[model samples]
Target: MKLIIAVVQDKDSNRLSKHLVKKGYRATKLASTGGFLKEGNTTFLIGVKDDEINDVLDIIQENCRSREQTVSPVSVMGGNVDSYVPYPIEVEVGGATVFVLQVEQFHQL
Candidate 1:
């Protein structure tokens, strides 16, 4: 057995959820936030057999697409507030950070 952990943008979560269900894969969705951009993200915990790993990966790859986005920096409330100027920078977002791991045990209660 294997566990597939996929962290994807909120924009693509719905679409990816649909695809995963249509392919008969079960997943647990959790609301999350990104560290860099502080944007909403969805983390999916999927458990599947070893042979199904590639199919789940392909589904994630097709659904979550990385694209450019302009984001303004968040200002911190500190001494440098007077000199701090927030600037919008182009960043790459909307992609899945996937991690696959081997499962030593599996149980359903």
Candidate 2:
């Protein structure tokens, strides 16, 4: 068995989950936040047989898409407030980070 852990953007979570279900794959979603961008994200926990790993990966790849977004820098409180300026910078987002691990045992109760 294999455990597929996928962290995807919040915007793509619903679509991706729907697609996975349509393909007969079961997934559990957990609400999460990104450390870098401090944005909402969804973590998908999918358990499948070894032979089905590729199918799950393909589905994730097709649903999760990366795109660029412009965001302003966050200013810290009480530091350099007198001469602080916020600038919007373009950064890449909306990509899925996936990890596949071998499961020693899996049982549904």
Candidate 3:
């Protein structure tokens, strides 16, 4: 068995979950917060057979897409504190960070 931990942006969470369910994959979603962007995120816990790892990954890849976003620099993230920059900078966002782990045993009641 394999445990798939996928942390995705909040924007894609709903869509991803729906897609997974439509494909007959069970997933549990948890609300989470991201440290870098200090934004809301969703963590998905998916348990599946070893052979289904690739299928899950493909679904995640197709649903979670990275895109450019403009945001004002914040002082906490090592931005210029002394001066104020009115213009917002472009940064890449909205991607999923996934980890696959081998499960020694899995049982459902």
TM-score list, all predictions: 0.74, 0.74, 0.75
lDDT of 3 by residue, 1-109 (tens): 9999999988889999999999999999988997633489999999999999999999998888678778775622465666665577877878888999999999998
- Cα distance off (Å), candidate 3, residue 109: 0.3
Clashes of each: 0, 0, 0
Local lDDT at 23 for model 2: 89
State the C-alpha lDDT per candidate. Answer: 0.86, 0.85, 0.86
List residue ranges in candidate 1 displaced over 4 A.
36-38, 68-92
lDDT of each residue in 1-109, candidate 2, tens digit only: 9999999988889999999999899999988897633489899999999999999999988888677777665532236676444676667767888999999999999
Candidate 2 global lDDT:
0.85
Which is better, 2 or 3, measured by TM-score?
3
Quality of model 1 by C-alpha lDDT: 0.86
**What lDDT score is found at residue 51 in candidate 1?**
97
Top-scoring candidate (TM-score): 3
RMSD of each: 5.2, 4.8, 4.5
| Candidate 1: tens digits of C-alpha lDDT, residues 11-65 | 8899999999999999999989976234899899999999999999999989986
Q: Which pairs of residues clash in candidate 1, taking residues 3 or more apart in a chain or in different chains? A: none
- Compared with the true structure, model 2 gives a TM-score of 0.74
